[model samples]
Target chain A: MKLVRIFFKAVTMELSRRMAYKADFIIRCFILVINSIISPIFALILYTTTPGIPGWKFEEFILFQGTLIFVFGFTHAFFWQLLSFTIYEVRKGSFDRFLLLPYKPLSYLTASSIETDGFSEMFTGIIIIWWAFKKLGLSIFSANFILYIYLVFLALVFHYSLNIITASFSLIFIRSWALMDILSSLVIFAKYPASIYHIGMVFFFTFIFPIAISAHYPVQALLSAVSYKLILFLTLSVSLFFYLSISLWNFGLKKYKSAGG
Target chain B: MKKYRELTKIGAKIALAYKFDFIVSIFTVPISIIVFYFLWKTIYAYSGLDVIRGYTFEEMVNYFIMSMVIALLGWSNIERVVEYDVLYGEMVLRLLSPVTYLASLFYTEMGLKAMSLLVEATPIFLIGIVFFKAKVFSILNLILYAIAVLFSIGLVFLISFLIGLSSFWLKRISGISRSKKLFLSFLGGGFVPLTFFPKIFQQISEWLPFQYIRYVPINIYLGKYSTFLALEMIGRQIIWIILLYIIAKILWNRAIRKFCGVGV
Candidate 1:
C-alpha cells in the first residue's frame, strides 16, 4: 500500500513536469501515435500488394497488431524507464542514491518512473482494436472476453519479467542498451499471427521466449476459444520465467559495485 | 579545409572508440533483414505469384538487403547531437570555434561514414552481392549510383542540420526529429518499394525529396530506370541538396543572431 502511494505521487509529479510544456507534450504524443501506426500502415501496403500472411485477413491481422501495440504500450508506460534509469545511473555512479532510499531499489525504481508517451500508443491501439472489432462483427460480452482479459494480464506480467531481465543486465553490463534494442527487434516477430511461421519458429517463440503470449494468445482468445491446456502451460511457463528474472536481478545486485562518484 | 580535415579525423576516432556500437549494428541490421525476408517469402508463397509490383521474390529480398546497405551509408545522427548541444549550452563553445560549425559537422559525418564503410557497410555489401546474388550493375550504372549516393548523403545532412538548427527555437526537437525519421523511412522507400504503393502515394512521393533519399539510388542500382532517367533523378537530387543548403544557411543566420541576442 505504501509503495502504491509513493508510485502515484511520483507519477503525479512526472505528469505535472511534462504538462508544463504543453506544446512539447502534445507533439511528443502525436509523434508516438505516428510511431505506433507506421507498422500497420506498412502492413496495409503489404496486404494491398499481395495476399498477406495466409489464413489472416487484413482486419484480423490488424487486431493482432493492435493487441501487440497495446501490450507494448502498457509495458513501456510502467517499466521501460527502469531499464534506462538503471543503466544511466549505474554508469554515472549515482545509483547509490537509489540504494540509500528507505525502500527496495527495484520496487522504488519501478514505481517512480512513468513514460507518458506510452499513453498515446495505448490510445491509438484501443482505437485500432475497436475499428477491427467492429469490422469483424465480434461481440464483446462473451466468455472469451473474460479469458482475453486474463491473457492480457499474463502478457503484462511476461513483459514486466522481460523488463526486469534487461534491467538486471544494465547493472552488470552498464551499457546494455543494445541488448534492449536487440530484444525490441526480436519482438517484432510477435506482431504477426503464429499460423504464418514454420512450426519450429512458433515453438521457439512460444516455449523459449514466449513473446507470442504477449499478443498472439490474447487476440486468439478474442477470435476463438483458446485451449485450456495451452492456458495452463502459459501460466506455468510465465511464472517460471518471472521467477528466473527475479533471480537474475538478485544476482545482479550481488555483482553491483559503486563507481564512487 | 585543414580544420575540416582535422574534424573529420576526430569523428573517425570517436566512432572507432565506440566499436561495440558497430558490433551491435552488425547484429541488428541482419536481424531486420531476416524478418523482412521471412515475411515477404511467406507473402509470395501464399499469393502464388512469382512477382508482385514488378519485383520477383529474389528482387524483393535483394531490395531490402540493399536498403540496409544504403541506410548504413546514408545514416546521420547530427540532429540529435546538435539538439543536445544547444539545450546544454555546449553550442557556445562550438560557436567560438574557428571552423564553420555546419562544415565541421559535414566533415565529421563524412569521417564517421568512412569508418562505417570500412568496418560495417563493406561486409554487408559483399554479403548481399556474393550470398544473396544482388544485382550486378554495369560500370556506368555503378558510377551513376555513386553520384546519386553522394547527393543523397548531402541531402540527408542538410535536412538533419536544418532539424538540428530548429533547436535554437524549440526547447526540444525529439518529436520533430522522430516524426521526420518515420516519414523518411516510409516515404523514402526504405520500408517498401514505392512501386507497390498506390498510384496517388507514388505521385505524391514523386513531388517530394523523400524518395530521392533511399528510393532513387536503389532503383538505379536495380536498373529500374534507363540511363537518361537515372541521370535525371540524380539531377533532381542535386537540386534538392542546393535548395536545402540555402534554407539551412538562412536558418543558421537567424539562429546565430538569436543566440547572440540571448548571450549564450
Candidate 2:
C-alpha cells in the first residue's frame, strides 16, 4: 500500500509538471504524432507495391503497427524516460540521491518520470486499431476482444521487462544506455507481421527476443481469433522473459557500485 | 588557424580516449541493416515484385545501408553542446581559453564523428561490399558521392547549429531537439527511401533541405541518378550549406545577445 501510494504520488507530480509546460507539451506531442505517421504510411506504401508480408493484408499490418505503437506509448511514457534519468544521474554521480530514499529505489526509478508527449502515439494507435478493427469486421462485443486486450497488456509487460533488463545493465557497465538505445530502436522490426520474416526470425522473436508478444502475437490472435493453446504459449513466453528480467535486475542491483556522495 | 588546429587536436584526443564506446556504438549499424534487410525481403517476396518504385530488392537494401552509414557520418550532437554551454554559460570558459568557441566545439563534434567513421563505418562498408555486394559505384560516381557527403555533413552541422541556438530562448529544449530529429529523419528519408514515399511527400521533402543529407548522397552512390542529376543534387547541397550557414550566423548572434547566463 505504501509503494502503491508512492507510485500514485509520482504520477500526480508528473501530471502537474505536464500541465505547467502545456505549450511545450502540445508542440512535442504534435511533433511525435507527425513523426509516427510516417511509419504507417511507409507500411501502406509497401503494401501498394506488393501484398505486404506474405499473409498480412494492409489493414492487418496496420493493426500490428497500431498495437506496437500502443505498447510503445506506455513504455515510452513511463518506463523508458525514468530509465534515462537514472542513466543521467548515475553518470553524474548524483544517483546516490535516489539510493538514499526511504522507499525502494526501483519504485522511484521506474515511475517518477512521465513523458506526456507519448499520449499522441496512444491517440494515433487508437485510430489505427479502430480502422483495422473496422476493416477486419471486429467489435468490442467479440470474444476475441477480451483475449486481444489481455495479450496487448502482456505485450506491454514484456516491453517493460525489456526496458528493465536494459536499465539493469547500467549497474555493471557505465554508459550502457547506448546499448539500450540501440535495442530500443529494434522495435521497428516488430511493427510488421512476423510472417514475413524467416522461420528462424519468427522463432527468435517468439522465444529468444519475445518482442512478438507486444504486436505480432496480439494481431495474430485478433485476426485468427484466440485459442487456449495460443494463450498457453503466450503466457509461457511472457512469464519466462519477465522472470528473467526481474532476476537480472535484482542481480544488477546487488552488483551495483555506488558513486560519489 | 594554429589555435583552431590545436583545439581540434584536443577534440580528437578526447574522442580517442573514448575509443571503445565509439566502436561499440557502431554495432547498431549492422543491427539496423539486418532488420531493414528482412523487412524489405518480406515486402518484396509478398508483392512478388522485383522492382517497386524503380528499386530492385538489392538496390533498396543497398540504399538503406548507404543512407544509414551516411547518417552516422553526419550525426553530431550540436544541440547538446550548444544548449548546455549556452544555458550554463559554459561558453564563458571557451572565451577565456583564447580559442574560437564555435571552431572548438565543431572540431570536438567532428572528432567524435571522424572516429566513428574510422571505427564503425569503414569496416561495415568493407564487409558490406563483400557480403551484400553493396552498390558498385562508378569511379566518377564515387568521386561525386565523396563531394556530396562533404557538403551534406556541412549542411547537417549548420541546420543543427541553428536548432541548437533555440536553447537561448527555450531552456528546456528536449521537445525541440526531438522534433528536429524526427523532422530530419522524415525529410531526409532516413526512415524509408523518398522513392517509396507518396508523390506528395516526395514533392514536399524536395522543397526542404534534408534530402541532401542522406538521400542525395546515397542515390549518387547507388548510381540511381545521371551524372547531370548527381551534379544538380550536389549543387543543391552546396546551396543549402550556404543558406543555412548564413541563418546560423544570424541566429547565433541573437541567441548570444539574449543569453542571461541563468546557471552561471
RMSD of each: 2.0, 2.6
TM-score of chain A, every prediction, order shown: 0.94, 0.90
lDDT of 2 by residue, B1-264 (tens): 777666667767877887766676456677677778888887777678788888898988888877777777887678877878876788777667775566677776666767777887787787678766685668898889878988887877888887777767766566777767667766887877788777887898888898888888988988989999999888888888878877877877777777766552
Native-to-model Cα distance after best TM-score fit, residue B199 in candidate 2, in Å: 2.9
Q: What C-alpha lDDT, on a 0 to 100 scale, does residue B8 get in candidate 2?
A: 64
For residues A79-170, write the lDDT of model 2, one tens digit per residue: 87767776777677677787788867777777576667677888888888898888888888977787889898898888888877777777
lDDT by residue for model 1 (A1-261), tens: 788998899889878878775666778888899899988898888888888998788998898889888999998898888887887788787888988999989999888868887789899989999999899998889898888889999999998998889888888877666777776777777767776677898887777778789888898888888898988988888888999999999998888887622
Candidate 1 on B179-250: residue-level lDDT in tens? Answer: 776677788999888998999989998889999988899888878899999999999998899899999999
The top-ranked prediction according to lDDT is 1
Ten consecutive residues with minimal summed lDDT in candidate 1 chain A? Answer: A252-261
* lDDT for each candidate structure: 0.84, 0.77
lDDT, residue B118, candidate 1 = 86
Native-to-model Cα distance after best TM-score fit, residue A145 in candidate 2, in Å: 0.9
